[model samples]
Target: MNVSINIKWPLIILLMLPFTLAIGCLIQIKHFAPEPLILKKDEIFTLPSGTNYAGLEKLLRRQHLAKKTCWLPWLIKLEPKLAEVKAGTYRLQPGMTVRDLLNLLVSGKEAQFSIQFIEGERLKEWLTVLSRAPYMKHDLHDVTPQTLGVKLGDPADSILEGEFYPDTYLYTATTSDSAILKRARQRMKLMLLKIWEGRAEGLPYETPQELLIMASIVEKETAIKEERARVASVFINRLRAGMKLQTDPTVIYGISEDYHNSITRRDLMTPTPYNTYIINGLPPTPIAMPGQASLKAAAHPEESEYLYFVADGRGGHVFSTNLASHNQAVRKYRQGHDIRGNNE
Candidate 1:
């Protein structure tokens, strides 16, 4: 025998009511979940030091990154340490969420700005470039080189030129120009000390400063890496042989603010502190910034009898031990010949 029972629709509905309510609540929570912000472009967000949760909310509001302004204040209630944010410029991504942005700020991952001080650049040119770097804080306007040295804690009474190390320097947006220069200056000092300590014995250079001056000349002489030591050797040989350096770059440096073209015979005859033709030794100051290769070459120059070199039309140079051979190489290069001089 089969038995039949009748169930009311209202009873079934009543039983499903609690589950229905629970599903609706879940749907609401999912709707309010954190999501990527809608930004057309990435921006730099700055959270100053000691910013509290409320301050962060205001900043986020201005940046259009905040979805729910109350979320952070409540979040700080849960994780109190999140309230302590570091001060820095941060690269806020286009799709970054409030959570992601907050995490980055709390993590102290600041945006980095870089400035490259190229080798062989004059100190004045370097300063001009540094002053124009975007987002870099500057205080060097109208500051004399002497005052700059004092600000950088240098006790030397002489002017600081070619004293800054040539390298790519990383800094924060708020980093002062003076601070970057100070680090470069310190780096150069350390490098000079280290190189001087291990310099070749019997080098004619009486001091590290002289080595720097010669290194600057070598840096300006050639851009080819393999030629640095060779060029430095020629200068050293000339110094030892009691010959005037007679380098064109040194002569040009002597002309200073007046130099703008090929060296003239009159310029060679002119006497200045930096004129190697008139002065039988290294210039009183470095003519340009020397890189590590040049510095190392100056400190540990190759042993060679080469006393002269000229541009070989190509990037490399033609070295010669005698005036006749040097003149011949210069003529060959001027004629655009690919002749590798016998001195090589």
Candidate 2:
């Protein structure tokens, strides 16, 4: 009887050992699952492509992100979907648990980065900004305005300046720079067409391109929202009266690399397709990228007799109906200002 009891007790102990180990493993998993990842602040974690569960386990262990990640293999086995981790950059925040990290890796929602194209800036500036942006695929090598315009499917004669809408664009890792520019161009085309269709009547502009050119001028003239229409009116009134636009921004655009934060008398007198001081009508192309407000203002200018404007020595401009008033305003606010002899 004693021998049978002893044999039965050893068999029972052996049977319970497996269950005990399983329960202990379950307890361990539960304890570690909710523990916070070893991060003081938000961190950027990148998982390379083709990495599987084993690779992920090795990475977590090597990075020391968790105190006890030896059970990760078992965890992944229990939840087979966790093994399917997508490759991309991820922003891991503090207080996130191991389970949360696993869920994020499988969610495939990679971190988003942004690039801003500012209004009144040229296409070259936008390209520079795009080139410096992180994680972008730089496909535009030796890019020029003409080449870029062709890539955007624009007309052979189309100028790329002011073609792209100035706004913040969001992109994921490995996104091409050209892709962002394409989106901006598409947005600009749609918005410009919409605004052109609803433009005010009796305007001097013959086409949507003319309106865009005027909008770019207005964008460079004044940044104040309230003054945009007034600025646009000055140019439109000039176009109607057959007077020279005589705008400084157009001359600067003509000067291009030669402009050194200040325009010289020679620059104003120089003859270029974009030089409005010497040119009869609107410049051949837009000077800079115009925002929505400038586009709207150029489409619908305020009803006024103003034909000239000069810097008001403030963040605004002084509009005038005639040369005398404009010269007087320029003399008062901007003494020795570079005003055109015939007009302002």
Top candidate when judged by TM-score against the true structure: 2
TM-score of 2: 0.92
Clashes of 1: 0
List candidate 1 segments past 4 Å from native: 1-33, 68-71, 144-147, 154-157, 337-344
Q: Can you write out model 1's per-residue Cα lDDT over 115-155, one digit (the tens) per residue?
A: 99999988877888888887778888876655666666667
TM-scores, all candidates, are 0.83, 0.92
Superposed by TM-score, candidate 1 places the C-alpha of residue 188 at a distance from the truth, in angstroms, of: 1.2
Candidate 1 achieves a global lDDT of: 0.83
Q: What does the lDDT read for residue 28 in candidate 2?
A: 88
Q: What is the Cα-based lDDT of residue 168 in candidate 1?
A: 98
Candidate 1 clashing pairs? none
The number of clashing residue pairs in each candidate reads 0, 0
